[model samples]
Target: MQQYNPDFDYKSAAEEVLAIEIAGLKQLSQHFDTHFVQACQTILNTTGKVVVMGMGKSGHIGKKIAATLASTGTSSFFVHPGEAAHGDLGMIDSNDVVLAISNSGESGEILGLFPVLKRQQVTIISMTGNPSSNMGKLADLHLCIKVPKEACPIELAPTASTTATLVMGDALAMALMRARGFSAEDFALSHPGGALGRKLLLKISDIMHSGTQLPKVTADAPLTEALLEMSEKGLGMTAIVDADNAVIGIFTDGDLRRLLSKRVDIHDTTIGEVMGPNPQVAHSNMLAVDGLNQMQERSISALLIVDDGQLVGALNMHDMLRAGVM
Candidate 1:
């Protein structure tokens, strides 16, 4: 008999599932030995894409694994077994490698499509719990992801097994990525809309203000005139440049307040006299996230972009903030 309580025992239920899945993953570590290396070598050596296919929960995991592989330098895509029967198998090239995922290693839909893939001489990689199953036996390389039991209390749901399979798939993707020397820039290119992409792909030139938009004035200009440029531009600061348009100084809103504290008259002072000399500058080629770092470190909100010592552009924290780089 069980007593009903207002507090459902979700914590214990979740913890038990996690504990079982963690153990299942640990068991999978042994399978990542020589067989795993051979599978990766086969995929990397071939000049072809990877085709990941499965059904049900395994299909979901296979889709994500395929995506991870694609984004990390390997060309790959997911194919539903049912879709393959309906004609999506045309996406697979003769040179492509087929990666089939099945916890039981006996999915009828996958096995039914195997003959055609085999006839085309496509290299096959199988991930399954049973080594003797038809899918495992027909593969060129096999990864065993056997689990002791399901984490589900009824021992019917695919919890621990699916988690183990997904982790193993990720391990394979990353292993191939590192083996091929895939760099951060490569990863950034495949994920240009995400955080790492913005950090690595967005250059200072892409977001900086230039031409008439740059807040700047000559050294001989009056402080009052520089103030007008700063206000017109609305960046709260103006760069003081020389005849060659090389940035020489910067006058910020904070600096204006400091001058006011000294009782200096803006109308009488020259821009050069009030500006901070040789202020820090950035290059347009530098990454925008790095520019954000420099700004934070210097306790400033904007930076001047100079190329070969000539002022080319300017940027503020607002630009980076709007770009979502921060």
Candidate 2:
């Protein structure tokens, strides 16, 4: 290993590497032609999953490409070429599409399986730096990722070429995503444990405080009583409802502060007299992320959930934070 040079301009060296990678991506973007469309169409028309195969550093990029395809509505998974030869080739079918990746376009492990894949009549899409390499020539379609040069000083490590390959994979995934009309909800279902899942799949009913957990006071109740309810519930606000439990207004800490500034009598004031009428509210079925948007739009910290004009639940920014809905 080379020793670190304290006086060397590491920032400039890093910027040069970035420049090479950027150039590679720009080159990749320009090469997106009919072959790219054909590859997308081939994958889209496949009834079975996309079976991505590669070796070495290409295998790492292939795995990521497979994952991206799967999460964005295209069913896909990575299979190491060496592993496929051992037995995983059985996982491929006539209806499946194979996405083989190699910078040199000569991965023997992958090329060795070409005959078997052809026998199965599976569609092959090769992504490589050479359009005429054995893998490309044998494939049904070839997508080139040839870059101007590698970012490595010795041109030994897979740097700019790998970056180009990854970007090409991304381009394919996104194009297929648009072609399939994949929505955020669709993406959320595939990523139930991720942040996008929480935002899109989580509903107000899933995280709201319902029943006795909801802070409420009748329209005729005193401001002091509402304050006590707000404190006990710890939501910093209380819904002011009518005799039939329908939401009439809301009173929050901000309301109380304004009342204090006006020197109003908390003990004598009716909740209805001081409450904010027609408060911003959402239905229990609304997406928690939508509720978040409502609060943000109105510049409020809390929201009351209602259904059919009846107060059903309440939630605040703190609840959104705890539920991972923010």
Candidate 3:
């Protein structure tokens, strides 16, 4: 093994490579001719799913492209060309679009499956470095992903080609996403475990405390009773509601401290006498992330979720935080 250098500056070398790859991707803006639009329109018109196929490093990029397309509203899956020969070709359909990725557009593994794929009547979208190669010529649509040079010092590795391929994949997915009018809610449906899902899919009713768990007091109730409700519910505040259970005011920990500091008698004062009226509230159907934004905007810690002006539930900042909506 070669001797390790204590001052190799690996981080700087990596940054230089990334910078070169980024510059290479910037150059691809010139390659987006009418053919790019045609490719997008063809994929969009296909009633069947998109099938991605590639080999080696190209295969890795193809898999990610498939996943991104799926998440962004285009249904797609990656099928290794090698695996297609071993019976996975059944995944393809006559109406589907096939995207074949190969740096040289002459990958034997991919070319090996072209005849059969063509028989299935699938439209072949080829992405390659050499547009004149056999795979590129045979494709119904060809996307050039050429690079000036590899970022590697020896010009042998695949840094620039891979970056160009990845950028092209992103462009395609984003194009399809916009063409389909895919919304954040649609994206959340596919990424239900991600932050966007928490923002778009989780509702106020799903996480708010309801029934006996809700820290609430009648408008006529004594301040001592309100304090007890807040303590029992473990929320930092209590909601003061009218006879119809409509939230009319709020009393928080800060209010309690102020009342105590002024030597106000909790036993003598009613919740209506000290509560802050016309407090901010939300509907149970509102997104939890929206509720969080509202709370942050109002500089308050809790929110009361009401339906038809009736308090259905309540939640505090800690609850939203615990739910990962904060």
Candidate 4:
């Protein structure tokens, strides 16, 4: 590697690169015409997945495009052009749409598979810098990803062209996402292990302490007993319930702090006398993210899950944090 140059004007060089890439993107935006709409409609109308194929740097971009399409409600996956020629072409179905990426629009490996693709009568959408190139000519649909220039000094490496291609891919993915009316819940279903998935898919019942794990005490219980239950359950709070186990009040660590300042007789005072009334509650089916929002808006750290006014479960900020729902 070249040694770091102290006087290289690195910041200016980086800014120039960004400016060129931005210009390429602007050029790309002008090409989003009927062809873009047709591409979206083709993918939406298909009963099979979008099989993306490319080579070299274009291949790398293809993988990302495929991933974005898959996560945004369009089922798609990337297939290496070289590999496809070697028997992976069997992955293609007649109902599938082939998205072929080649900056020059003349990748031999990609073009070599076209005859077979056409024989199978699969729809082909080609993304390229040259619409007149053979691969583009053979495609049923052509999307121009031509950029003004490459950021490379010699103009050999794919730079602005790849950026334009990736943005074009994003435009297609988002347009299809909106066209399908894909909701966050649907996106979360495909990304169940991600943070957004946890926020959208996890319910209050999924992480809340329930049954014997819940901290609760009878309304007539002494304040000291409520504290003992809170300590035992390790929830930092305890619910005060009536004879039917219906939640009437709640006492938390904050309440204990205030009670301590007032020199209240914990042994003699009943929990019902000092506990907070009209405690904010949620149903078991409430989303964990919504529960987090409730706690945040009310300036509280915990929430009680109740069903028909009966105390059922409890959760706090710690639980939300642990569940990755915070």
TM per prediction: 0.92, 0.93, 0.94, 0.93
TM-score of 2: 0.93
Q: Could you give candidate 3's per-residue lDDT for residues 192-295 as a string of tens digits?
A: 88677888899999999998899898988988898999899999999998888888899999999988999998899999999999889999999999999999
Question: Where is model 4 poorest over a 10-residue stretch in terms of lDDT?
Answer: 26-35
Q: Assess the local accuracy of residue 299 in candidate 2 as a C-alpha lDDT between 0 and 100.
A: 99
Expressed as tens digits, the lDDT of each residue in 1-326 for candidate 4 is 87987888988888999999999998787789898999999999999999999899999999999999999999999999888888899999999999999999999999999999999999999999999999879999999999889998789999999999999999999999999999988988988887888998999999999989999998888888999999999989999888998988899999999989999888889998999998999999988999999999999999999998789999999999999986
Writing each residue's lDDT as its tens digit, candidate 1 over 1-326 gives 98888898999989999898888888888898787999999999988999999999999999999999999999999999999989998988779999999999999999998899988899999999998999989998899999998999999999999998999999999999999999988888888887778899999999999999999999999988999999999888999999999888999999999889999988998999979997889999998999999999998888999999899999889999888899
Q: Model 2: per-residue lDDT, tens digit, 85-107?
A: 99999999999999999999999
Q: Which candidate's TM-score is highest?
A: 3
Report, for every candidate in turn, its global Cα lDDT versus the true structure: 0.92, 0.93, 0.92, 0.93
- Ten residues in sequence with the least summed lDDT for candidate 1: 188-197
Candidate 2 versus truth, CA RMSD in Å, comes to 2.0
Candidate 3 lDDT (Cα, 0 to 1): 0.92
lDDT-wise, the better of 1 and 4 is 4
Pick out the ten consecutive residues of candidate 2 with the lowest summed lDDT: 22-31
